[model samples]
Target: MSPVFAALKERHPNLRPQFYMSDCADAFWNSWRAVFEVEGVTRLYCIWHVWRAWNAHIMKVVDDARRSQLREMLLKLTQASTPHAFYSLYNTYAEIMNSKEYMLKDQNKKPRSLANTSQKNMSSTTVANCGLVSAAWAQISLPTCT
Candidate 1:
């Protein structure tokens, strides 16, 4: 964030940074209003923290099959033009992968590492790069003129 701001400042020498942002939520909200009041820019947290949080549940539900499905889902469902669609797909996939059946897949089976099986090779479908979503959301967003 700082680097981007610095580059922007260098290019537009008239611009000035009003505040710094860390991951602290208190600091962000408390200072955000002041920063935007002084300059039009507001500092905030990136998707990294959100992604980390969502992935914790993903690791639990991950198996080989679900992992493949997740990768493909992210590839297909995420689009810049439709943030709603992207988020909807995420919520839907989260539901499927976190279902009772999926969650209980290992309760009865003994933990065995099979090198060539889906059980061993799969990651959860939930672990995805937020950049994909961000890029997809960058294009003219779909109208929700409601």
Candidate 2:
């Protein structure tokens, strides 16, 4: 990847990308910074990967109805076209996830609250650790790459 980036840079010294879309991989990000050297590039993670990672954790929700609801909320979040819409959906999701009705049981059947989880893990940042939806929507009106 570094060699490819180096070659591209060598071929087009003026080429600078505004946005880069990739899966949530540390190596890819590192290469993008260290090798690509595009100062203002906005890194965007694949929504599919983010959804899959969140789905894994959401599957642990004890109630099937709540689990399905959470999935729908996540889908809506990813599809949000504006920052306001994204944040509104996110707040609703957070409210429900933090509610007592959304409790998860331990191996001993003890109720466990996801409230103890870090905000980063509980929110959309769990997988990508980046504000994927909000950031992407913020740039919705930007000109597309040719």
Candidate 3:
């Protein structure tokens, strides 16, 4: 717990420790609160458990099919050897609720992801974390390689 939380509770009598937090019922809610919604600001949690809760079931059905088709590409992306190549690979949806035929139509345009790239698009800090360079942003450097 942050000192700010302790202080806020002192200021507001209604704000119980539990009120300021999500209980076992509001599971993701608590994780969200602890991370992003401090003082009403929130950031998405990037934890695997959360993802498994959200997407694991959706992806299980087509897992073998995808592995046969693009396992190698998926492997490199997982290993992060070619961070940029991830966008060109297959995306495994943890919450695959739609039919395979329906999903595949949109999959080609988006490409499969080893990551949730949409989150990065929502935050610049994420892009930098991934070491992405802008296509339009030119590089200016003096070559030093012998």
Candidates by TM-score, descending order: 2, 1, 3
Weakest ten-residue segment in model 1 by summed lDDT: 109-118
**Using Cα atoms with residue i matched to residue i, what is each candidate's TM-score against the true structure?**
0.33, 0.63, 0.28
Per-residue alpha-carbon lDDT of candidate 1 for residues 1-146, written as tens digits (9 for 90 to 100): 44554565567766555323244244444544433344533332233442343345346566666766755653455322344666677567556645634433333221111111222322223122233343433332121111
lDDT (tens digit, per residue) of candidate 2 on 1-146? 77777777789878887556666555666776776666776566565565554565556544676677767876776555555776787667656655744434321221111111223333433323245453433322211111
User: Which parts of model 1 are misplaced by more than 4 Å?
Assistant: 1-27, 34-45, 71-80, 83-91, 94-146
Best by TM-score: 2
The candidate, 1 or 3, that scores higher on lDDT is 1
Off by over 4 Å in 3: 1-40, 67-124, 127-146
Write down the lDDT that model 3 would get.
Answer: 0.32
Worst 10 residues of 3 by lDDT: 136-145
Whichever of 2 and 3 has more TM-score, that candidate is: 2
Q: Which stretches of candidate 2 lie over 4 Å from their true place?
A: 100-146
> If ranked by lDDT, best first, what sequence of candidates would result?
2, 1, 3
lDDT of 3 by residue, 1-146 (tens): 44555565567745423112122123444553554435632223232432342244225334666644333432343334343443333133212223343123222121111223344343444433233212211121111111
Clash counts per candidate, in order, are 3, 0, 12
